[model samples]
Target: MGGRVSEPTTKASQFVVAILAKSGNIVTLYQLDVNNAFLYGDLHEEVNMTLPEGYFTENDKQTEGNMFISLFVYVDDIVITGNDIDEIKRVKTFLNSKFLIKYPGVLKYFLGVEVLRNDENICISQRKYCLELLNDYSMLGSKPANTPIDLGLCVVCSPSEKDNLLSNITKYQKLFGRLIYLTLTRPDISFVVQILSQHMHAPLQSHLNLSFRTLRYLKGSHGKGVRMVKGNELSLKAYCDADLGKCKLNTRSVTGYLVYFCNSLVSWKSKKQATISSSSAEAEYRAMGLTACEIIWIINLLRDLNINVKLHVELMCDNSSAIQIAAYFS
Candidate 1:
């Protein structure tokens, strides 16, 4: 028996970024927990399933005048926030009448992300999550490293290195999965995690060791996280960079970009280019294009939240030739 279910939900990164962008304002954030969340979704297709002995026991957006409200849903967990307090309460009342829900007073924690706010700025971290992960892997006692990965360390396993393949792939997969989620708050390890993920299909012992190194780095920098300061201008600035032929296995360039709303970092990525570029200029141009797309998306998101980008979106790249090409096109 098999089935597929899909729901519209806000991405973790998108939700975090949106909240950060509006931090220090008169906004209110709250969490709603739905009981038996999975049992409530409408199934589009029919499928077979083995029912448990007590299977029958399971159970499960709007805006106000001049008010902006955002509802983020991950399955049954709902985070409601807006500038209008009355509207938020009305939403909760309406939702509670439809299904069973527990209203958590504030969003202190959700999906492993811990939210902390001060008078000046809002900080998000996964310190508890990191500690739990380290303890689970028995790496809590490991000496902390200064960096997530060794500089100039290329994780390339050749045919002659077949013997170096990890014997148990499940352990590596689980650890890697956790690392992937950790990136929601730990952008510092993003590049290394992106590199490690490429080898999940066939991880080598060396890759496992490198994963350990990431854990050790996490040990040292667990307190580090994204900080969103209040009163920053709602302007977009981006920086895009590329390392030509950085992927040792495929010879593809790596593209990295960081997008900020004023002083707060909202979006960033470290990824390998789809195809090989003949020149560093070409690689850098590709990165610029990707960054532009992200900027456009962020602008639209802000527009939906009733925030306008009045100033020009600044996209910075170090490549002179690539900058000239972009300017000429404009």
Candidate 2:
């Protein structure tokens, strides 16, 4: 059977890839697929098959059993995945010995995404996918912006913001959905995507214009991606900050926190806080506590990684009064 979307020689999606634990210190995640995974067993005795063109002169010696391998047909496609690479290679060899053989390498990218993995971390992104989206939306030629949301910009379209819904309003919503998926690797664009998504159900022309700010940012950050680092230092560290009263619509505080894997950013989020803080100290203290939870989770994940880490995480907050309050809580 033919493989999926990629060239047979270079891609490895025909087989499956997975990582498994070995000896607690070593992890072996092998990827292999049956070359013709479905064509594994010998054919049934009742089936008599004619030989293909040119193989036999009607005088070729017949094997004791049927000539066909087990055929599980799914529109002539096959898929196989297992922990043993040798068994996989053996299957490939057996198939090659019996019929035409072709295979690909480690399963990196499939469908539209490009996947890259290392001991430090795994990175998945769709730069190609986004470019396609941009080209489809005629945004490939638009000027690039450095940030997803401009600090100078404010949402002003309102009160009958309904009147100017884009004739292409659905297009605007579609791009928002794509961009929101992209935020999985780019939390830096979170606040922007979240803000634009607020208007997706009833997007106006002004709303549509404001949404492209993220696409502009994506244009510039074509190379930006997440990295999880493997490090000798195992202590969790978190940094939290707040821009007091940043939301223009309400006096809500925007809480931002960064969680690190060693020194690398693994998870971080920025969103408007739910409740109003009575004082700057209270806001800062709240940020520290939220980020502290992040630190604890990271520490536990590291333990799962078998790093044998301690729970001595530092939650950094700039407000001295907040720090003083933290000491009281501790």
Candidate 3:
């Protein structure tokens, strides 16, 4: 799916260069995205097909398997990620050999989010994406809202009034999906995405309204992205958060964990726990245990990087009792 187009590199690509320049790292950069990634494959089972652009038919002698896999394309944009500069360059070279390579160096932008590489870190955000979303939804002319959610504005709706609520849900659901993908590079939005996701199944008007609030928040913090800078050598650290009794429906707490490698963020999670905890300590401990599990996996990943973490993968939590429990339980 690697090929070239008329456009320059992604916005994130530009931001990455700026960030790297700021950090004074001898950073090397390259860029490529999945080539006609959609065109490359076909639905294995029965499905309706739609005519694609720049359509070309294969020879009569060509078999289905011989047919070129159409890499999916969104107006020529594609998704590709890599860590090794040499490897990325290699891929770019190979793609150029096959298709016209539009040389967009380094991934400055992906999925509308801007990226910057600074001081041993990679920062990503979607301030621009947010603006576009607002404009696309016609919120550009509408007044900006102050909060991501209005706690006093309840979202509960009755079944008979489902139509209005359902409409809002559909709108918000679409946004939530986008935001969820956005979480890949922006952990700051994880909590809100998680909160909004709970209502996806039966989104009411209130739910949709809150979703708009989230969009407003994004508007305010548009172009924000994570900066995975190298930190204090190659060490593994984890931070966890849990909100006990946060959900009114089930009284279930929300738990979150983030994993960093050599001070660069690698993994994160935010979700509701299965069961309710009796106390803050219990809740914190549950979250800590989950965070530890992630740490273990991260440890294995780092091993492949030729990095070894000698001490315990440190887990940080704001709660003292949780810290004590982690000390004894882990």
Candidate 4:
């Protein structure tokens, strides 16, 4: 079928992590591989495809109904999670009967991210991926940087600096794409990656240098990852901030927010705003609005999963003027 096959959202990983944290030490995570998962998905639109080789539609029938075990599928890979061991086993057995499925006992590695589980906590990291990236750029042995970006470094769209343009545009684009993917588990470099991504279309030498500096920073903290510990509380808390006129060329402010479910860091974003704000208070208010929207979305998602979120979700902002503006507007 030429129709769109809706892939699982990238936030699936974060959600999985949050669930694991909520379950504490009693969680059971099963990794699965379906020989041809796409073929399993019930086609919404009529897809006329000549049977590939030996494959036939007669043998493959679609199954519908509510699944007891919670499953998240990303193309071929699937993560089956639940507390009820019998239910998990039953689902696995059913899938095996229908499709050629391989059940990996525990989720150690999936989507280039590694998972380490102990009695107390679960740790997620992309150490192997980070090392491979450094080696690809011949920066494995480079001195590590303490920070992703230099304290005084200012990156902007410099069209007049024609001589500073990167020689190979494709390479710059490729690096940026890889780094962006790396941010899935590496939130430490999220802000800098967001900044560099803005100039992917016309990357200058300064941009490339900053990207390298980010790589060096990754080298220093290659083993660092997010650790989700067992916690009794399932509180939803968010913190948001803004930098006024952070974008030197466009004069647009940057909004950054981090969200936590209980003590687990579930989501975060660092992006430049579309509209220009005249004052710092206005910028801060905009950031708050953006964060509130995210909170609402997350709350709805949790509700869908049957996890009740605390009615009063905490949203924290440091700016007094922004608080006043929000209170006034309310």
Highest lDDT against the true fold, candidate:
1
Residue 232 of model 3 has an lDDT of 48
Distance (Å) between predicted and true CA of 313, model 4?
1.2
The models' CA-based lDDT, in order, is 0.82, 0.58, 0.62, 0.78
List the candidates' TM-scores in order. 0.89, 0.62, 0.68, 0.85
lDDT of 2 by residue, 1-330 (tens): 211121333221111111111112232322233455556676576533334457665555564122212222232333333334566566657756865544445535443445576665555566777788677777888899978777867765353645576666678878888887676557788777766676777677766776776777777776666655445565556789987776655677778887665566666777777888878888888888778766655444333323445466777888999999999878
The Cα error of candidate 4 at residue 159, in Å, is: 4.2
Ranking of all candidate structures by their lDDT, best first:
1, 4, 3, 2
Tell me the TM-score of model 4: 0.85
In the range 122-216, model 3's lDDT, one tens digit per residue, is 66667676777778777766655556666554445444554355743466668788778767666776777787788777876666667777777
Query: How does model 2 score by TM-score?
Result: 0.62
* Residue range 109-202, candidate 1, lDDT tens digits: 8888888997888889999999999999888889999999889987775534454777789999999999999988888898999999988878
Off by over 4 Å in 4: 1-7, 10-22, 36-42, 45-68, 159-163
Model 1 residue 119 lDDT? 81
lDDT tens digits, residue span 164-246, model 4? 77778899899989999888778889999999998888888888888999999998999988777776676788999999999
Model 3 weakest 10-residue run by lDDT: 64-73
For candidate 2, the per-residue lDDT at 27 reads 29
Count of clashes, each model: 0, 2, 40, 0
Question: For candidate 3, what is the TM-score?
Answer: 0.68
Cα shift from native, residue 141, model 2 (Å): 2.0
